[model samples]
Target: MTANATLSPADAVQGQLEAYNAQDLDAFCAFYADDAELGAYGGETHTRGLAAIRERHAKLFADFPQNHARLLHRAVVGAHVVDHEHVTRAPGGEVFEVCAIYSFAGGKIARVDFVK
Candidate 1:
Protein backbone atom coordinates (compact mmCIF):
# COMPACT_ATOMS: atom_id res chain seq x y z
CA MET A 1 0.00 0.00 0.00
CA THR A 2 1.25 3.49 -0.79
CA ALA A 3 0.00 4.94 2.43
CA ASN A 4 2.55 3.07 4.57
CA ALA A 5 0.29 4.14 7.35
CA THR A 6 -1.72 2.31 9.99
CA LEU A 7 -3.79 -0.77 9.17
CA SER A 8 -6.92 0.19 11.02
CA PRO A 9 -9.95 1.15 8.97
CA ALA A 10 -9.98 4.62 10.45
CA ASP A 11 -6.35 5.13 9.62
CA ALA A 12 -6.83 3.59 6.20
CA VAL A 13 -9.69 5.97 5.49
CA GLN A 14 -7.56 8.89 6.58
CA GLY A 15 -4.70 7.73 4.39
CA GLN A 16 -7.06 7.09 1.51
CA LEU A 17 -8.41 10.60 1.84
CA GLU A 18 -4.89 11.92 1.86
CA ALA A 19 -4.08 9.91 -1.23
CA TYR A 20 -7.25 11.10 -2.95
CA ASN A 21 -6.50 14.74 -2.19
CA ALA A 22 -3.01 14.10 -3.53
CA GLN A 23 -4.47 12.40 -6.61
CA ASP A 24 -2.40 9.31 -6.07
CA LEU A 25 -4.41 6.60 -7.76
CA ASP A 26 -2.27 3.68 -6.67
CA ALA A 27 -2.17 4.93 -3.13
CA PHE A 28 -5.88 5.55 -3.12
CA CYS A 29 -6.68 2.06 -4.38
CA ALA A 30 -4.26 0.49 -1.97
CA PHE A 31 -6.59 1.18 0.90
CA TYR A 32 -9.44 -0.73 -0.67
CA ALA A 33 -10.31 -4.40 -0.82
CA ASP A 34 -10.20 -6.39 -4.00
CA ASP A 35 -13.97 -6.86 -3.93
CA ALA A 36 -14.82 -3.41 -2.82
CA GLU A 37 -18.08 -1.86 -3.92
CA LEU A 38 -18.86 1.80 -4.51
CA GLY A 39 -22.38 3.11 -4.69
CA ALA A 40 -24.31 6.31 -4.40
CA TYR A 41 -26.46 7.26 -1.43
CA GLY A 42 -29.63 6.75 -3.44
CA GLY A 43 -28.45 3.60 -5.20
CA GLU A 44 -28.61 5.34 -8.55
CA THR A 45 -25.32 3.74 -9.65
CA HIS A 46 -22.61 1.45 -8.37
CA THR A 47 -19.24 -0.07 -9.20
CA ARG A 48 -19.28 -3.68 -8.07
CA GLY A 49 -15.64 -4.73 -7.77
CA LEU A 50 -12.06 -3.60 -7.54
CA ALA A 51 -11.41 -3.58 -11.27
CA ALA A 52 -14.56 -1.62 -11.89
CA ILE A 53 -13.68 0.74 -9.09
CA ARG A 54 -10.25 1.35 -10.56
CA GLU A 55 -11.65 1.88 -14.03
CA ARG A 56 -14.23 4.34 -12.78
CA HIS A 57 -11.64 6.29 -10.81
CA ALA A 58 -9.22 6.30 -13.69
CA LYS A 59 -11.78 7.99 -15.86
CA LEU A 60 -12.69 10.41 -13.12
CA PHE A 61 -9.10 11.36 -12.43
CA ALA A 62 -8.43 11.84 -16.07
CA ASP A 63 -11.63 13.72 -16.68
CA PHE A 64 -11.46 16.08 -13.73
CA PRO A 65 -7.67 16.55 -14.02
CA GLN A 66 -7.61 18.85 -11.00
CA ASN A 67 -10.21 17.13 -8.89
CA HIS A 68 -9.64 16.89 -5.16
CA ALA A 69 -11.58 16.33 -1.99
CA ARG A 70 -10.92 18.16 1.24
CA LEU A 71 -12.09 16.57 4.44
CA LEU A 72 -14.23 18.95 6.46
CA HIS A 73 -15.34 16.53 9.15
CA ARG A 74 -14.95 12.88 10.16
CA ALA A 75 -16.86 10.51 12.38
CA VAL A 76 -16.06 6.91 13.23
CA VAL A 77 -18.28 4.30 14.76
CA GLY A 78 -17.02 0.71 14.94
CA ALA A 79 -16.09 -0.43 11.43
CA HIS A 80 -17.88 2.46 9.80
CA VAL A 81 -16.23 5.79 9.04
CA VAL A 82 -17.98 8.84 7.68
CA ASP A 83 -16.37 11.82 6.03
CA HIS A 84 -17.80 15.16 5.06
CA GLU A 85 -15.86 16.55 2.16
CA HIS A 86 -15.69 19.58 -0.06
CA VAL A 87 -14.89 18.46 -3.57
CA THR A 88 -13.47 20.68 -6.29
CA ARG A 89 -13.71 19.66 -9.92
CA ALA A 90 -11.22 20.47 -12.61
CA PRO A 91 -11.37 22.64 -15.74
CA GLY A 92 -12.99 25.45 -13.74
CA GLY A 93 -15.88 23.37 -12.44
CA GLU A 94 -17.84 24.00 -9.29
CA VAL A 95 -17.20 22.80 -5.77
CA PHE A 96 -19.69 20.66 -3.95
CA GLU A 97 -20.03 19.13 -0.52
CA VAL A 98 -20.57 15.39 -0.06
CA CYS A 99 -20.69 12.84 2.68
CA ALA A 100 -19.00 9.49 2.21
CA ILE A 101 -19.75 6.47 4.31
CA TYR A 102 -17.07 3.80 4.29
CA SER A 103 -17.18 0.19 5.42
CA PHE A 104 -14.12 -1.93 6.02
CA ALA A 105 -13.41 -5.61 5.81
CA GLY A 106 -10.24 -7.66 6.10
CA GLY A 107 -8.31 -4.47 6.84
CA LYS A 108 -9.38 -2.77 3.63
CA ILE A 109 -12.30 -0.72 2.46
CA ALA A 110 -15.11 -3.09 1.45
CA ARG A 111 -17.77 -0.61 0.45
CA VAL A 112 -18.44 3.09 0.05
CA ASP A 113 -21.69 5.00 0.02
CA PHE A 114 -21.48 8.52 -1.32
CA VAL A 115 -24.16 10.88 -0.16
CA LYS A 116 -24.17 13.90 -2.40
Candidate 2:
Protein backbone atom coordinates (compact mmCIF):
# COMPACT_ATOMS: atom_id res chain seq x y z
CA MET A 1 0.00 0.00 0.00
CA THR A 2 1.09 3.55 -0.61
CA ALA A 3 1.64 5.56 2.53
CA ASN A 4 0.21 9.07 2.78
CA ALA A 5 -0.99 11.60 5.37
CA THR A 6 -4.53 10.24 5.11
CA LEU A 7 -6.07 8.74 8.27
CA SER A 8 -9.70 8.02 7.43
CA PRO A 9 -11.48 6.45 4.46
CA ALA A 10 -12.40 9.91 3.27
CA ASP A 11 -8.79 10.97 3.50
CA ALA A 12 -7.64 7.84 1.76
CA VAL A 13 -10.00 8.45 -1.14
CA GLN A 14 -8.93 12.05 -1.25
CA GLY A 15 -5.36 10.89 -1.52
CA GLN A 16 -6.39 8.62 -4.36
CA LEU A 17 -7.85 11.62 -6.12
CA GLU A 18 -4.59 13.45 -5.66
CA ALA A 19 -2.76 10.59 -7.30
CA TYR A 20 -5.23 10.62 -10.17
CA ASN A 21 -4.80 14.34 -10.74
CA ALA A 22 -1.10 13.60 -10.98
CA GLN A 23 -1.90 10.86 -13.54
CA ASP A 24 -0.46 8.22 -11.25
CA LEU A 25 -2.65 5.26 -12.05
CA ASP A 26 -0.59 2.96 -9.87
CA ALA A 27 -1.33 4.85 -6.69
CA PHE A 28 -4.96 5.41 -7.59
CA CYS A 29 -5.73 1.75 -8.25
CA ALA A 30 -4.02 0.75 -5.02
CA PHE A 31 -7.00 2.07 -3.08
CA TYR A 32 -9.35 -0.60 -4.40
CA ALA A 33 -10.01 -4.23 -3.48
CA ASP A 34 -8.26 -7.10 -5.24
CA ASP A 35 -11.63 -8.31 -6.50
CA ALA A 36 -13.17 -4.91 -6.80
CA GLU A 37 -15.97 -4.11 -9.19
CA LEU A 38 -16.46 -0.71 -10.81
CA GLY A 39 -19.89 -0.06 -12.28
CA ALA A 40 -20.11 2.69 -14.83
CA TYR A 41 -22.67 5.39 -14.22
CA GLY A 42 -25.74 5.34 -16.53
CA GLY A 43 -23.96 2.79 -18.67
CA GLU A 44 -23.77 -0.94 -19.17
CA THR A 45 -20.04 -1.10 -18.64
CA HIS A 46 -18.92 -2.84 -15.47
CA THR A 47 -15.39 -3.86 -14.77
CA ARG A 48 -14.89 -6.68 -12.28
CA GLY A 49 -11.67 -7.76 -10.58
CA LEU A 50 -8.41 -5.90 -10.31
CA ALA A 51 -7.16 -6.57 -13.81
CA ALA A 52 -10.36 -5.42 -15.42
CA ILE A 53 -10.53 -2.35 -13.27
CA ARG A 54 -6.97 -1.55 -14.15
CA GLU A 55 -7.77 -1.81 -17.84
CA ARG A 56 -10.79 0.41 -17.47
CA HIS A 57 -8.83 3.02 -15.55
CA ALA A 58 -6.02 2.86 -18.05
CA LYS A 59 -8.37 4.06 -20.74
CA LEU A 60 -9.84 6.68 -18.46
CA PHE A 61 -6.44 8.00 -17.48
CA ALA A 62 -5.46 8.18 -21.09
CA ASP A 63 -8.64 10.02 -22.04
CA PHE A 64 -8.54 12.48 -19.18
CA PRO A 65 -4.99 13.00 -18.04
CA GLN A 66 -5.82 15.71 -15.54
CA ASN A 67 -8.89 14.33 -13.82
CA HIS A 68 -9.41 15.18 -10.17
CA ALA A 69 -12.14 13.94 -7.89
CA ARG A 70 -13.31 15.69 -4.74
CA LEU A 71 -15.65 14.48 -2.08
CA LEU A 72 -18.49 16.91 -1.45
CA HIS A 73 -20.15 14.93 1.37
CA ARG A 74 -20.06 11.55 3.06
CA ALA A 75 -22.21 9.33 5.27
CA VAL A 76 -20.61 6.47 7.10
CA VAL A 77 -22.51 3.58 8.62
CA GLY A 78 -20.18 1.01 10.12
CA ALA A 79 -18.01 -0.30 7.26
CA HIS A 80 -20.22 1.09 4.55
CA VAL A 81 -19.10 4.43 3.15
CA VAL A 82 -21.15 6.58 0.83
CA ASP A 83 -19.62 9.60 -0.85
CA HIS A 84 -21.08 12.34 -2.99
CA GLU A 85 -18.28 13.57 -5.19
CA HIS A 86 -17.51 16.03 -7.92
CA VAL A 87 -14.91 15.00 -10.44
CA THR A 88 -13.29 17.65 -12.55
CA ARG A 89 -11.99 17.01 -16.02
CA ALA A 90 -9.27 19.58 -15.97
CA PRO A 91 -8.62 19.58 -19.69
CA GLY A 92 -12.21 20.56 -20.44
CA GLY A 93 -12.90 22.28 -17.09
CA GLU A 94 -16.05 20.18 -16.80
CA VAL A 95 -17.36 18.82 -13.50
CA PHE A 96 -19.61 15.84 -12.87
CA GLU A 97 -21.12 14.85 -9.56
CA VAL A 98 -21.79 11.25 -8.62
CA CYS A 99 -22.65 9.30 -5.53
CA ALA A 100 -20.71 6.17 -4.76
CA ILE A 101 -21.43 3.50 -2.19
CA TYR A 102 -18.44 1.50 -1.07
CA SER A 103 -18.10 -1.56 1.10
CA PHE A 104 -14.82 -1.90 2.91
CA ALA A 105 -13.27 -5.05 4.24
CA GLY A 106 -10.00 -5.31 6.11
CA GLY A 107 -9.42 -1.63 5.45
CA LYS A 108 -9.71 -2.13 1.69
CA ILE A 109 -12.62 -1.40 -0.58
CA ALA A 110 -14.30 -4.69 -1.54
CA ARG A 111 -17.06 -3.25 -3.67
CA VAL A 112 -18.16 0.01 -5.24
CA ASP A 113 -21.40 1.07 -6.85
CA PHE A 114 -21.84 4.42 -8.56
CA VAL A 115 -25.25 6.08 -8.60
CA LYS A 116 -26.17 9.06 -10.73
Candidate 3:
Protein backbone atom coordinates (compact mmCIF):
# COMPACT_ATOMS: atom_id res chain seq x y z
CA MET A 1 0.00 0.00 0.00
CA THR A 2 1.10 3.55 -0.66
CA ALA A 3 1.99 5.82 2.22
CA ASN A 4 -1.19 7.78 1.63
CA ALA A 5 -3.26 4.63 1.78
CA THR A 6 -2.67 4.53 5.50
CA LEU A 7 -3.14 8.24 6.12
CA SER A 8 -6.43 9.43 7.47
CA PRO A 9 -8.27 12.37 5.95
CA ALA A 10 -7.99 14.44 9.08
CA ASP A 11 -4.31 13.58 9.37
CA ALA A 12 -3.67 14.61 5.76
CA VAL A 13 -5.38 17.95 6.23
CA GLN A 14 -3.66 18.73 9.50
CA GLY A 15 -0.32 17.66 8.13
CA GLN A 16 -0.65 20.00 5.19
CA LEU A 17 -1.67 22.88 7.44
CA GLU A 18 1.41 22.39 9.59
CA ALA A 19 3.59 22.14 6.51
CA TYR A 20 2.09 25.31 5.15
CA ASN A 21 2.79 27.24 8.32
CA ALA A 22 6.34 25.95 8.26
CA GLN A 23 6.68 26.88 4.56
CA ASP A 24 7.80 23.38 3.69
CA LEU A 25 6.73 22.91 0.08
CA ASP A 26 7.58 19.24 -0.24
CA ALA A 27 5.93 18.32 3.00
CA PHE A 28 2.86 20.38 2.17
CA CYS A 29 2.46 18.79 -1.23
CA ALA A 30 2.91 15.30 0.14
CA PHE A 31 -0.60 15.32 1.53
CA TYR A 32 -2.24 15.84 -1.84
CA ALA A 33 -2.87 13.43 -4.69
CA ASP A 34 -0.95 13.97 -7.87
CA ASP A 35 -4.06 15.05 -9.77
CA ALA A 36 -5.67 16.98 -6.97
CA GLU A 37 -7.73 20.05 -7.76
CA LEU A 38 -7.93 23.37 -5.97
CA GLY A 39 -10.47 26.08 -6.59
CA ALA A 40 -12.80 28.66 -5.16
CA TYR A 41 -15.87 27.29 -3.42
CA GLY A 42 -18.17 27.92 -6.34
CA GLY A 43 -16.00 29.58 -8.91
CA GLU A 44 -13.02 29.03 -11.17
CA THR A 45 -10.36 26.42 -10.58
CA HIS A 46 -7.08 27.79 -9.30
CA THR A 47 -4.92 24.70 -9.47
CA ARG A 48 -5.33 21.36 -11.21
CA GLY A 49 -2.46 19.16 -10.09
CA LEU A 50 0.18 18.65 -7.46
CA ALA A 51 2.76 20.39 -9.65
CA ALA A 52 0.51 23.38 -10.05
CA ILE A 53 -0.30 23.41 -6.40
CA ARG A 54 3.38 23.44 -5.59
CA GLU A 55 4.02 26.25 -8.03
CA ARG A 56 1.25 28.42 -6.64
CA HIS A 57 2.23 27.91 -3.02
CA ALA A 58 5.87 28.44 -3.81
CA LYS A 59 5.13 31.99 -4.87
CA LEU A 60 2.78 32.52 -1.96
CA PHE A 61 5.38 31.44 0.57
CA ALA A 62 8.03 33.56 -1.09
CA ASP A 63 5.80 36.61 -1.08
CA PHE A 64 4.62 36.16 2.46
CA PRO A 65 7.39 34.66 4.46
CA GLN A 66 5.62 35.49 7.69
CA ASN A 67 2.31 34.04 6.63
CA HIS A 68 0.54 31.92 9.18
CA ALA A 69 -2.86 30.28 9.50
CA ARG A 70 -4.67 29.71 12.73
CA LEU A 71 -7.25 26.99 12.80
CA LEU A 72 -10.50 28.15 14.30
CA HIS A 73 -12.55 25.03 13.67
CA ARG A 74 -12.39 21.68 11.95
CA ALA A 75 -14.88 18.96 11.16
CA VAL A 76 -14.59 15.61 9.52
CA VAL A 77 -17.42 13.84 7.72
CA GLY A 78 -16.67 10.63 5.88
CA ALA A 79 -13.85 11.41 3.46
CA HIS A 80 -14.07 15.16 3.74
CA VAL A 81 -12.58 17.57 6.22
CA VAL A 82 -13.75 21.14 6.66
CA ASP A 83 -11.63 23.81 8.28
CA HIS A 84 -12.23 27.40 9.24
CA GLU A 85 -9.01 29.35 9.51
CA HIS A 86 -7.77 32.83 10.22
CA VAL A 87 -4.77 33.74 8.11
CA THR A 88 -2.29 36.58 8.34
CA ARG A 89 0.10 37.29 5.55
CA ALA A 90 2.57 38.91 7.89
CA PRO A 91 2.85 40.32 11.35
CA GLY A 92 0.39 43.24 11.35
CA GLY A 93 -0.41 42.60 7.71
CA GLU A 94 -3.36 41.46 5.67
CA VAL A 95 -5.71 39.20 7.56
CA PHE A 96 -8.61 37.13 6.34
CA GLU A 97 -10.87 34.24 7.23
CA VAL A 98 -11.16 31.18 5.06
CA CYS A 99 -13.23 28.04 5.06
CA ALA A 100 -11.62 25.13 3.33
CA ILE A 101 -13.31 21.93 2.32
CA TYR A 102 -10.91 19.10 1.77
CA SER A 103 -11.99 16.03 -0.18
CA PHE A 104 -10.02 12.86 0.27
CA ALA A 105 -9.58 9.86 -1.98
CA GLY A 106 -7.40 6.86 -1.29
CA GLY A 107 -6.33 8.51 1.92
CA LYS A 108 -4.93 11.60 0.24
CA ILE A 109 -6.45 14.98 -0.42
CA ALA A 110 -8.01 14.85 -3.87
CA ARG A 111 -9.36 18.39 -3.96
CA VAL A 112 -9.73 21.52 -1.88
CA ASP A 113 -12.38 24.19 -2.21
CA PHE A 114 -11.89 27.54 -0.52
CA VAL A 115 -14.38 30.14 0.59
CA LYS A 116 -12.75 33.44 1.44
Q: State each model's C-alpha RMSD to the native.
A: 2.1, 3.4, 2.2
lDDT of 3 by residue, 14-68 (tens): 8899999999998898888999999999989889999999999999999999999
Better of 1 and 3 by lDDT: 3
What is candidate 3's CA lDDT for residue 40? Answer: 98
Cα lDDT for residue 62, candidate 1: 85
Among all windows of ten consecutive residues in candidate 2, which has the lowest summed lDDT? 1-10
Q: lDDT rank, highest first? A: 3, 1, 2
Top-TM-score structure, candidate number: 3
Q: What is residue 62's positional error in candidate 3, in angstroms?
A: 0.4
Task: Provide TM-scores for the models.
Answer: 0.89, 0.77, 0.95
Off by over 4 Å in 3: 1-3
Query: What digit string (tens of lDDT, one per residue) describes model 2 on residues 1-116?
Result: 36243446665666566676677878877877788777755555487887887787889889887777787898888777788988987756888998988776656666778987
Which pairs clash inside model 3?
A: none
lDDT of 1 by residue, 22-116 (tens): 77888888888889999898685478888898888888888887898888999999999999999999656888999999998887899999998
Residue 112 accuracy (lDDT) in model 2: 79
